[model samples]
Target chain A: MENVATGEAQRAAELPMDNDAFAGFYERSARPLRAYLARVSGDAALADDLMQESYVRFLCAARSWDGEVAGRRYLFRIATNLLKDHWRRARSPSIEEIPEELFATSPDAARIESQFLLGPALAAMRPRDRQLLWLAYAEGYSHREIADVTGLASASIRLLLFRARRKIARLLREPEAEGRQGRAR
Target chain B: MIPKSCPRQSEVAAQVLRGQWPAGCVEDLRQHVNGCRACGELVLVMLAFQSARAQAVSGPAPVSAGVLWWRAQLRRRNAAVERIARPILGAQIFALVVTIAIAAILLVAQARNVPRWFSWLTQPGQSPGLHFEDLWSSALAMPVWGLMLLVFGLAAVAVLGGFVLFSDRPRQ
Candidate 1:
């Protein structure tokens, strides 16, 4: 298969859908999809690139958007596949990036502070761990849906998710423990 | 953070995701989440994820939706062009190969039996110039026919291959 740039780099003017209709879909799906890619791939820029390409592929896909929920799932599945393909084709592994710049953009101080902690823990965990947690709690996708998006078997999601939660819990505890020591000192 | 999970933790998370937490949920579940260590941690993490999602959703999209849609349209068009071009290119190559093969067979058969001084125009007198009548002649053995066919085939391939190579060259 060709890379993400194979098509996006080319000029296309074949309008397959109404402009306003696509705009609505893009507005609803873009940010959340970016967030999902950023956290899972640990590269915010790649997430952004991948997000744009995913929509392009999504629109180009032959399937119907009959079910709105199904459309969202299909979008995620496309993004996930693209991300995996990027990782597979890359000469070196992608570096983990939390996009600390984004934290300042958020007006909610409390949420930002919590995310500061969670981001690293997510970054420190394996790619699949971040994927499972983000999809499960962040997107609220069920185990079966997670299976569909990640291309993992449904039966293994629970055990894998359970292990992922435990790992994050351990990672989260360390900084808190350090903070407690610093406070006591 | 707790490594263990409360039985209702997933349930509480589901409620939170559905945006039905605390108010929509039964009072007992709220009390339990507050009291259970695992559930409390779960709540904190889930809320953080929710807030992060909110921030991302509210943030500006990297590219405008209109541009994205256009690019998607363009990409689809490009792919369609590629899909159509692929078979046409394949058929062109197949026809070229078949033409060369037929040319080679005819050339080789003519070469094997005909004398070094053969002419396309039939001679006015003497033995007919290498006509089909020569097929049973002593000079034209079966192996000679096969050899001639081989030579003719090679000539055809060379001629066709050269034509293809020259035709494919880019114009200055």
Candidate 2:
């Protein structure tokens, strides 16, 4: 067999050609990917499964990487495609319908209550909206970058975000909207 | 000094908490929230919301054993292909080289065995079996033919062994 080092190095040097430099990339990117998947799917277990599958696909495609910016873009591009495929193959569950038991029980009731409140509010939002929120808030992608990743109009990103936030805020503030709980008096 | 160019404290706090604002905007945002109690409280609530959301959405731990098993299976399959490919390539090259050498040796042997020493001195009525036909047929019956077959058979067996050893077993 040809040397794994030779194959990997050849692939790594192509564009974002530093395959050797992926340990840091993995650590930084994994959580963001997981978080993105979880929010979009509204199912932590499904998100975990997809995250692992996405990484396996990434490893398979590592030999074909072009360079740094392009490589990172490709990684996200693959992830987005996988997510789209998942949505296409499987019927998306209503985030509003995600079970209460999915949230962790914190010793602090306030923490648990806030989580319970936020989980389905996030779920009721569109998948693309969920992705936009997580990428902007958690992954720190700018509007233009999020635009590039999602293939949405760049100028529309700011507008879409404004709409998403306002909707989320309203959803969070109103328990009747979620149907699972009552607002405090 | 807080810039007049910035948005209202509450709006900017909302933007920052939503991660819509640029990272460079955080310093200006902090300055505004420091003096404004309402903005400070809103930012605290937003931060708390973020923390809770993060905690709630975190996925389960990875299955290390399953990942390891997958990697092991991939490596084994690759190793088996490599073992088989190397020797098959080597044997093909070796056979070509050996075939060329043997053909050259036989040509030289025929050239030297052509009665080069005695041909000039012999009468025209010499033994009929001394012709090229007799010499060519005798060379074909030599032990080298058997040796060549043995080499080829061994190479085939080695490749077959590699295939048998490396082929994946169907998991139950």
Candidate 3:
């Protein structure tokens, strides 16, 4: 009986840091997660809040984390769900308010500024289109990676990216980028 | 679907951005983009987006010197959530509760002098020094039969309660 108790205690000792593991894991994944969230929401504050919530969720789920599953991929998967939830909770605007200074920043400015034009272009897109563009372009995800991230078929990634690019290009060409919707025809 | 009016190379640029470059198309796109300034510029923006994002700070914002203390508080909050959730969700707790209930009912029936299967087993006729009242009353009374019955009862309760608590029932 004593031996069995000791063995169980030893096994528990080797398991992932029950609560202590969250700090290190959060530190490791936070930066990329923030950037990913920032681009998706186009609002830094909202991204920050989502980042905190995502990590809290990560910590809660960590009790179930098997060390073999790549932690980063799972975390991103969680973040993707949270992002979808965030979007769903938001009411759709009759007209998207496009910012005029999209892409107006110098190339070396903050990525947010560098992608300002892309931001509204992203905002102008349907949520799925925005997700496809961000997952591919900003997250450095391959077609397969985007497919995993968004649960879309891998074979369709190229076609979807193509469609996303056309939409962005059409948006960029609008004479009044903010007020008028792009006319692809 | 690719817009029919888009330059052939722009489609290639999207593929390249996705790291899915087709060898045949890359060269053709390169030559066309070299000749066309608009396609060339779009390619630059796309490439820049990728590069800049790669360098972006992803996680939490900057924290002050007392982040360790703040983290401790967050840990407490998380632990509290787990503590609350565990009792509601823990299989063992539910099993323990059920076991205690069953044990109490058995002990009560014994107290009431009711003819219980347990009392019948522990009755003096079948086994010496095994009457529940005497075995429990006497000092150093091992009450082997009662002890064994108690252990077996607890084990059965644990197993049965576990199945009830953990097994999923199909919705009607």
Cα lDDT, all candidates: 0.71, 0.58, 0.58
True contacts kept of each: 0.57, 0.04, 0.21
Clashes within 3 Å, all models in order: 10, 9, 9
> Model 1 over residues B69-91: C-alpha lDDT tens digits?
77877678777656644654675
lDDT of 2 by residue, B7-98 (tens): 47547555756666446466776687777654554444355346655664464444453462355335545544554457656755666566
Interface root mean square deviation for model 2, in Å? Answer: 8.7
* Model 2 chain B worst lDDT window (10 residues): B1-10
Off by over 4 Å in 3: A1-29, A59-71, A89-115, A173-178, A182-185, B2-30, B35-45, B51-55, B58-172
Model 3 quality (TM-score) = 0.51
Clashing pairs in 1: A12-B74, B104-B152, B104-B153, B107-B152, B108-B148, B108-B149, B108-B152, B109-B148, B109-B149, B112-B148
Every model's TM-score: 0.67, 0.49, 0.51
Model 2, residue A160: distance off in Å is 1.9
| Per-residue accuracy of model 3 over A11-112 as CA lDDT, tens digit each | 433324444565566655677777777666666767777767666555545356756235766667777788777755655331124332331322333454
Q: Just chain B of model 2: what TM-score? A: 0.31
Please report the candidate that would top TM-score against the real structure: 1
Query: Which regions of candidate 1 are displaced past 4 Å?
Result: A1-18, A90-115, A169-174, A177-185, B1-7, B23-26, B108-172
